[model samples]
Target: MTSSDTYQGLAVTTPVSLMFGRFSDAATPLLYARTLKELLAQSGLQKDDVDGLAVSSFSLDPDPAIALSRSLGLSLRWFQDVNLGGASGGIALNRAARAVAAGDADIVACIAADNNLETGFQDLVRDFSVASRDGVYPYGAGGPTSVFALLTKQYMQETGATREDFAALCAGQRENAKTVPHAVFNEPLSPEEYLASRMIAEPLCLYDCVMPVSGAEAFLVMSEERAQALGLSYARVLSSIEAHNTHGDEASPLSGGWATGRDRLFANAGLGPDDIDIIQTYDDYPAVSILQLEELGFLPSGKGASQLATSTHWQQKHNTSGGQLSCGQAGAAGGYLGLVEAIRQLTGQAGAWQRANVRHALVSGYGMVVYDRCLATCATILAAQESL
Candidate 1:
């Protein structure tokens, strides 16, 4: 019930200024699409090669299809605007796969963009408070950090976890980020250093949080039949699920909604956790992501923190790309940054951070309900080839 038709080839493209970390004195800024046409034109596809446009993002002022339409001078047969929080990106990829199979459109594009952190640091932190739902905003400021703080506190109380234990997660993920070229935070971390880091919330330190970064990534999606015709090497979209925990007060009881979402999606795909080689977890904070993994069945519900700090998990390639904490966050597009990394790992192109012989990738998008702290979540498993 959760699986769908597969896609042929998937390719990633980004705007020029966003590609290199050398311009602006190697500074990264929010990507502007003025140069996207050139990069896209160089994609080797004919001008009319694309017929479908699917964009999942939070920060692109003008949606991508409309922008790409004027820039590339093409009309589209299908257009999708996915506004879900974290899970929005992967959900779009799943929809594109189904559309390709249904003959809705070929050469569909799944796009997620990131922007520079320098220009918007203050704006972002302040806006975090405004992100609360109307109902919860009155009682207390229910932003990402506050809600996760409450959740992290509960996880700690239940699991006998300590801030030092959580620090293990910060230290480990930072090490993972150091191996990733595009990672903004390439610095190595230590548990002691993690303990010393300034606390933004009660338990989460500065390094425990995901930074705001400017950039964008894209995937060219098509049917397997179309892929054979084009001769491209890419992955297929296997399964996807999106569930809204619109009521976070209720989410407190489950406390494992994200993992439940992943289980549901993979069940639909007819596979279990063992089939996945890598995963990109939605992480605004390191602990939330770590907890999400356990809920995802990689570890027991309350065992996320323990596994997060283990050297074996890294060697096993579970959360390989350092997660959003080390990379950078761009609202909804943050998940795609993780997806792009997963795609790279699967395609043997992850460069320095490539996991050894990766194949299946399960990506989880955990989003703030826009109503409460992580009110909804979505997960998708992508494969290099047909598995069944």
Candidate 2:
């Protein structure tokens, strides 16, 4: 089936729960359990009501999605284990929505979690991919930071982007972080401070890297009828698209696969970029987020840097949760951060940092950095319940 043809009438509604902050005692399964408990409490859903399960985690090794059902004592009729990293949330939602639409499951609980032990991150980066283990790590590439620094340098040279341009975006996100109680970086930040921060990798400073933390995020997917019956407010998925390995052959990649299906994505949603009230892009690095904006039709390709530098549009409506930059990247849960935040803003649950009239939101994910660039790309447009 085509990407747009997978789930025509399914909607993600109700009871989105997120648990942030660094957890020293939590394991992967425990995080999943806590999130599920909160989700059930928020939605008033009994354990038996969840017939489908979708999970994404970096530390759930040895145990998979099916294992979680047993550990959580859930009798699921459908299950999925999403390992797409940053793209896992979008992919899990797409799959769970399709299952609900197909009558294979009544309600699907999608979750992502991980524990950040002392050596967990290092171990993950080392084994992220064959290319990294055999090629990049041997030279002390310093994991994702090094890989993205090269891309940032090339992006700057190609677009004439100055350090100030990147710093401005970071500073704006920090400002947004001040309102998010769970954000790890809540202190006031200025472009001057961003420019002066210690550089981890050339062109990528400490602010540019996502801090590793242990946490989980979860949301539920069901039919619109079910959500209404439960008297729950939900976000409707107007359109979604996923692509992988689009530019695998391109050396030193500049764009992701979002460009491949952007036209169809907006067409399927019957909405354009201008209609979106807010945007959330996978922000392992600011450069990647800018690339997503360009490739997803918000800005002209290769022009994101200049537009971001001159425009204040993003400062007000983009990544309102301060994104992973301020919240800390919680393993696979990083992928779900934007999705959960979008749901909160749309459902009137984003108390302090909520947008005024968030009728529609654009959320994008890019992940699975192999050798040169991220191989997976996914995006979804969500509409408020009132709009539906």
Candidate 3:
């Protein structure tokens, strides 16, 4: 077996920032610039040090990653435009790690940002998928809420999950949001409130869906030695996996591609589900979060809703940053939320809501819900440098 140590040598270190909530003046490029500026400032690195870049954005149309490099005055040796929606962050991390390990770049900045102006979200939803525009939207299917509501209903029927189960998860995340400085929804949420909230789609109350806002998230990937030399604390990527168009035959997806490579992911990390100390899932919807937990082995298949309702484990440290549901999904930046939050928790930088003695974090992403199911899925296992 190839030694996991070789892969673990690559690390994601300091200079992580998440800007949440609405930004009317800012466009996508401005949001990207803001995150890049903070990343450079925090890492104490000059723009010249960023030899590689990876960008993810929904509204950065007519401009690709290469275009942003020039706009930002960055002459890069490597660049990538990740458009995988929520999975983009994981893929970016995986790519950046490989780039640094292969000597393609010494330092890489992975960023996802976007501005959600008036009508911006409606436009995105209208053109999100061919199936949506051609088939679903015409019938007023109500975009992702409708799509996910169908999935949630199926999941509940199969697993005997009640609306309260979903409400509990949303309420718990809202409680966690209370400590995050940038979270958009800081109000205490009770299960009663969640249950009483207006229903956007059947079985999916207003609180069950994520609020779209404008923001950005960013992080740096480089050699562990480079991070240490910079006096930065870092998180090591124990293992990562990505898959596309998984389980395509299913009418609606109850599981994601994370399960396809989950065994390999754990094997490469030399760890298992029980070893994880924290979890961050791409929570565009509460039901999606539950599905990711099941696919990633944190909860048993078909048991996520029941476990979430009954278990105290999820209430404590999962989605410690309140997730996008509370922080507001900032277009493509939603993909990086969990990854950035996991890095924070693992590096002991998650102030206020930081869990004690966090050594391992499991982060997962699911995106590109075009037709009947999400086409992209990815997961990562991050460990504290000391644990490595």
Candidate 4:
């Protein structure tokens, strides 16, 4: 990992993502500036050192890249505004990483954020569907909550997956969330609790869905050479894949774009399922995780729940940051946030939730398809410095 500056070392000097940064009480101009300033100061990088920007968020509008650059006095060499839904952060990092590695840009900044707590449900519905074309929204699809519910219903019939099984899946996530400090729903919950929660949509109780959480998670990424020059602990960006399920609802029904994409991503990384020590599966709905795991060869098809119910393999604690259900799904940045966690786990910096000797990790991203579904899945293989 530390041979020379001329080589692409296995260590990361620039960030792929930030973890457990925060949920601001409010998104004031001061608060926004403070968040950026804090991260820059935290990393000890000066304003001029920042030369590029990319961002993904649902609530972070009003030209985030420009405003953030202006706030930090950064002269951005390249900038990107990502709107890939749950796949946003992942896409952004992949973009920035490739850009930096190719010498197209250096000192790239990737940010994902949200400022919703007590955010109106109606507003969320309207805003979420905006990603869809007008023709697609009129079906009253609502959001992923409703979309996943229908999928869960169909899945329940196919696998004889009782509502209890789904509850258990989410309940495990909630329990894992208990260990993640920044997870929005960090409180402990039992299966009874998940089942008892009000139904936002059939087969999807309130607990199964992601909530609006406010926080800005930002990463300062520089080329591997610059990172060595600065002396930062980092992981290597091994490989990545992004797949879009352009067929909308029907696509999710037939395939795990998320799951299938993971298969291809790992193949590209030339590592198989066991090679991944820890994982962060985008769980917009719990079934997505089950379906994706099966597709990625981590679990057999139609037996994901059975495997999850009995597996020792994942006992190392996947998504200890509570996945999306616990981790605030910053819509656009949700995917990247998962990628950031892979980085943290690899670097052994994930506090309280740290696992033993995490080297390689898997992270997945799901994007909006339509009618309350996101079959678009992407994955990345990340390795700790030593592993690389």
C-alpha lDDT score of every prediction, in listed order: 0.62, 0.85, 0.85, 0.66
Q: What would the per-residue lDDT of candidate 1 be over residues 1-388, giving only the tens digit for each residue?
A: 2254343343333211133331122222124242234335534566477787766554454454366455556578877766565776777777776676667887776665544445444443345434454454454543456666766777788887788766777667777878776677779878888888887767767776676665556666665555556555566666777767634557463354665456557766667888888887877776667666777787776766776666566434655767767766653537566666676676666677778766688887776544445656777777765343
Using TM-score as the measure, the top candidate is 3
Score candidate 3 by TM-score against the native: 0.97
lDDT of 2 by residue, 1-388 (tens): 6544565556686534454456545678988888889889988899999999999888988775578898999998999988888999888888898889888999999988888888888888999889888988777759988888999999998888878888888888888889887788889888888899999999999888888788877899998888888888888888888999987778868879898889988988888999999999999899998999999988887888767767777777888888999888875838888888888888888889888999999999998887778888999988888885
Per-residue accuracy of model 3 over 217-287 as CA lDDT, tens digit each: 88999999999998888999888889999789876678687888999899989899999999999999888
RMSD list, candidates in order: 4.1, 1.6, 1.4, 3.9
lDDT, model 2: 0.85
Clashing pairs in 3: none
Give the better candidate number (3 or 4) by lDDT: 3
Best by lDDT: 3
Instruction: Look at candidate 2 and give me any clashing residue pairs.
Output: none
For each candidate in turn, the TM-score is: 0.83, 0.96, 0.97, 0.86
